[model samples]
Target: LDNNKFVETRFGKQLKPSSKSTTYDDVAENYDGQYRFAPIQEAQVSRAMIKRYFETMYDRAISDVVIVGAGSAGLTCAYHLASTRPDLKITIIEANVAPGGGAWLGGQLMTPMVIRKPADRFLQEICVPYEDEGAYVVVKHAALFTSTLLSRVLAMPNVVMMNATAVEDLIIHEDHAGQQRVAGVVTNWTLVALNHDTQSCMDPNTITCPVVVSATGHDGPMGAFSAKRLVSAGLLKELGNMRGLDMNRSEPAIVNNTREVAPGLIMAGMELSEHDGKNRMGPTFGGMIGSGIKAAHEALRVLDS
Candidate 1:
């Protein structure tokens, strides 16, 4: 799909939930996308998603589709693009010591400390003894698979894998007499782990691209989010329904800002909790993968144009 095939603003194309009822349960009512019984599926979905994104960003002449987290969504996106388009230039920037953000989260599926019924059994199977190959293999597979895929992709002339870098600001530029533009990102990071407790970071640096994909996992610094943030915050004031990201924060993560400040910034794999939204498949891997795929599809549409 070419970029021109899709409109810049896909008005009226927003996702519609299967349910609209505002139940009394804050879980259901207030608005958040969460559910149980899904984890590996999310990984599968995200893998499929970033694959399409690679093709799109590649053709569009966009230099980089840099992802901040590089854990689940970031790594998934990287592999997807790398596998499909070894020619495209892709980068993954992670803050944590390792990849797989949600993998180490520590619930039943996420954090293991607080145990549940089948969850305990699930954890037990997937943990130390490694009875259930499901959990063990899942993580093991991610480790082995991603490593192999990454090795091949990295060997390709087009990929750059950066770990432990913190991105701080964005650089935006306009082209075609200010009608269109390019974007660049600035980040500060620490490469050497002097000690587990204390480490120093190198000076900040900037990487520029015509089209920028802000896949920081969590809402980045302050302003670098996306168009969704502004619309969610600004429009709600007039209508009295501020129903979008940044649940607890004063400012939401996905807002609409100028491209020169945030050029061609399209966001995907975002959380419904970030906005006034929820779903059984809410913030899980299922949603991010779906969104990542959708976002990539859209990005391809943009590039094809």
Candidate 2:
């Protein structure tokens, strides 16, 4: 061995020195003896975590369609879009950590979800078992129904399911033709508002999508948020309810009225009632599912055009 060359020994074994130098002092500073592997391993893990986090953020930021509220309507719309248009990126943003808004708890915790005959085929496709009880098909277990739909939607590769996120505002922009269109949404963590932990209103992060679906159900934030923006921009008239004498006409009215209210914005489920003044048919899963399918079709048409 040359006298100028220094070899490092670890646990009675000769270890190869770093490529930079064969001196003990140089290798000691560069490598931590037996713990030399720790730094490299930590670095790899850190890089992986950062890559995963940012990749998800990037995907969400560039989603093609963003549906607020992951209820029956939202999930159905997502599932339909994912099945038909696998190439398009879809994201479902739900305020609650658990998916299936209203479907899980129904009217009360004890109440099971009831879907009419119209939604039977959809229920069967998702493998939700229901018993026909005269006027309605009664779901034996609300949780089971909710889980089945949620699981199916989550299984889609192009569908991103985001829980615990709430849309605070809608992103509106003017197209080349000078038409006002809803471009995306501003969202924040639901816990921030639920806990009231902030001293002032926190600004939310924005997600850009060509199409935005307001499946936020009755009293959803998206409808009111978009309404304010559209009305102010002169794209929409003052939001008002259409006075209908017969409340019984709500079911068909709701299903038929599910459509795009503005450029690049579609309303589904109970949200349709807000736009068209359709009577609120309480807890009718069939109408909600039909509305969602209609909304999904409208969104596809808008995208295609």
Candidate 3:
């Protein structure tokens, strides 16, 4: 969640925690950061905060535990962490319009998920299937091996899911705690949707948590921007001086087997692709889960301190 990746859904598909309006993988690819710009008066991709950058976006005052993508990693992290510590408030902001991000096209659920349990297969290999009733093909990409275990985490009660919500910007402030140290994490999202009728924090509200868990993957809604910013600011020295799409940057699509990016502000996932039994042993899914969990744990550590 570390502010940008994915959360797993019950459909054996990824769900956007805060998104009932968008899909997880779709958001993953759509927000790939290279989705292209409209060239609004000479390609002016504002370096300003995301709130001032794009239109039709929304934000949820997501502090504490706010997951980004609502994919396997995010859901896993949320489930695992929540299982580890049920009291930690967790919120997922998904950009997809529905859960099971990729189960069916007309709302009629599929059987593979309920039958063969494809998630385990997704963790170990790329799945491709064709139907006799159509001329189309379905392809499921690979991810880290632990991805399948994401199931147990989803069933936990501590986990809350939100859909159709996309992150617009992150507000990182430095507040001092009794003159001991400085810290802060208040992320903003774009287009927050929830069930109507008089309810609790079911609407667009600001939530403050001592820790922020972002699971938005490599090319996450905010992770990509954050990485680019770090590079622009020269925080990632080991890779070199660059931003967005640079050789140093590791987008999920760049996975060529099992390579990974370094550990900077964004924990590189592609690095673990070498592990056996993994789908591709690259970053994206695995790195996202590992890094998101690490971020959550680290955030919790910071909170405890």
Candidate 4:
């Protein structure tokens, strides 16, 4: 209670005032009252968000590439595709509220992510810091890599991410060559899709794209969704399903098998593992990264041809 001293709050912690006298009002003004943003009504906020999001959806109704699942492989594929061809419109549909998928955590919910040597080139390309461990590299926090990659991909003008949007089915059609192939995706709100058992029947919408990248993971709640749907649709004979974990074999197989499973439908990431009955690589992300890059190249090739 000294006459010359005044208590101030710094993030809920009390701090002794300096020689210069500071009043409660001064601290309050410096913190809470410093924001000069325009007052916005709740309705206006809703309108703004809806307007922007719907406009984006409408504009990207017909995209060059529609990547299902915004996991590591999908995001990386989008990043490379968008970076390489800014003219190409890319739409990434993610079922979860947040993107990044399992890349946000390493094996068994650990923080550090393991990336083998050659795949570390992608880390260097993205300028993400990592620790060298002989043949492998370690990202201090998995989130660092996922967030950095996500932010960079989303920053591209032609790239759009629709999280909380679930792709229910693939649209199959006959091409001019009389070949039946996946031509688009049927989508619905993730919440609606999740609550389908209790909710009334709601028709899903469709978005057509020349190329579709199925980067959904393996044996997850919604993993390998596109791949499984393709099998059900008769486009693919069957998904061999995923084999047990075997990093050495799985890692190489995943990258090697990243290719077009059906016309216009390219499988990447863990989806490739399940589609080809390959082994699971666990937390090692080298295969995922390599698969994404290869998928992007394949997509570019398809588009160019």
List residue ranges in candidate 2 displaced over 4 A: 1-51, 193-201, 220-229, 232-234, 241-248
Clashing pairs in 4: none
- Against the reference, the lDDT scores of all candidates come to 0.42, 0.76, 0.39, 0.88
Best by lDDT: 4
Give the C-alpha lDDT of model 1. Answer: 0.42
User: What is the TM-score (0 to 1) of candidate 4?
Assistant: 0.87
Tens-place lDDT digits, model 4, residues 1-305: 46335443211123355667866667668668663446778999899899999999899889999999889999889989988888999999999999998999988989999999799999998889999999999999999999999988987778899989999889999868978988889999998888889967888989999899999898678888987887888877988889998998998899988998898999999988778899998999999899999999999988888
The C-alpha RMSD in Å for every predicted model, in order, reads: 19.4, 14.0, 17.2, 9.1
User: Could you estimate the TM-score for every candidate?
Assistant: 0.48, 0.76, 0.42, 0.87
Please state the error at residue 184 of candidate 4 in Å. Answer: 0.7
Arranged by TM-score, best first: 4, 2, 1, 3
Tell me the tens digit of each residue's lDDT in model 2 across 1-305. 46345443211123346577556665667765532434467788889889976688787898889998888888888878877887899988888787787888555566677887677788877778888888779887778878887777776667887788888778889878987888998888887745546557666798999899888766544334454455677777775543343435776787788888988899887766655666776766788788888888988998898
Off by over 4 Å in 3: 1-63, 98-151, 176-205, 220-225, 229-289
Please give the range of 10 consecutive residues that has the lowest summed lDDT in model 2: 6-15
For 221-242, candidate 3 gives per-residue lDDT tens digits of: 3333333433444434432222
* Model 1 vs. true fold: TM: 0.48
lDDT of 2 at 221: 42
For every model shown, the clashing-pair count is 35, 0, 59, 0
lDDT of 1 by residue, 137-203 (tens): 1222334333433454345445565556555555555566864343655655544322324645444
What candidate 1 gets wrong by more than 4 Å, as runs, is 1-62, 105-157, 175-182, 190-203, 219-263, 271-283
